[model samples]
Target: MNQTQKIQNPETNVPKTPQMNERDFVNDQLTTEKYMTASYNIALNEASNQNLYQDLATIFKETQDCQRNLYNLMFKNGWYALEQAEKQKIDQTYQQFTGYKTQLPYNVQ
Candidate 1:
């Protein structure tokens, strides 16, 4: 089985010129969303006012969801290339995390 399988749909046609294209625009939006999510996360952590925190939290969720949707759209159009992780690697990661689970305040077992 090929472990480096790329999950993507047929790429949409776009003009190849110095000007911005559809893919470029969507990619830019994705980048912006990524930055926004990071900023929101920081703000959420530092927020002191309960009402402001709640409002920011809600907006953060919305922004995060929008970021996901944009990423999906880009993937659907083959704008984003993602490689599948191997099962062995995934299992190793899971095992490592499970080992660290013991450090939690509660028992996970």
Candidate 2:
């Protein structure tokens, strides 16, 4: 039960050099897009002008999408990895969240 399982693709080898590799480039871009989206979220929250808010909102959506794309690409190339959650843990979490459904406004049950 203590065994760890990871979900990942076959890793692509890269020369460990001073220059950045494909994974590094994609990761950097993903990080940048994440930062941009966060900043846009803050700006949108405090934006006084409707037009400016709309424009920023559009750009935020685009940046968020770009981040997802980069993340997908990284995962495909084995640069990104994720742990596989145990079924018991997942079921417990699901039950916990389901217990909160009654607290919702409507009948989301």
Please report the candidate that would top TM-score against the real structure: 1
How far off is residue 28 in model 1, in Å?
A: 0.4
Q: What lDDT does the true structure give each of the candidates?
A: 0.94, 0.91
Model 1, residue 62: displacement in angstroms? 1.7
State the lDDT of candidate 2 residue by residue for 1-109, as single tens digits.
7566999999888879999988788899999989999999999999999999999999989999999999999999899999988889999999999989978989883
Count of backbone collisions in candidate 1: 0
Structural RMSD, model 2: 2.0
lDDT of 1 by residue, 24-89 (tens): 999999999999999999999999999999999999999999999999999889888878899988
How badly does each model clash, as a count of residue pairs?
A: 0, 0
Off by over 4 Å in 2: 103-109
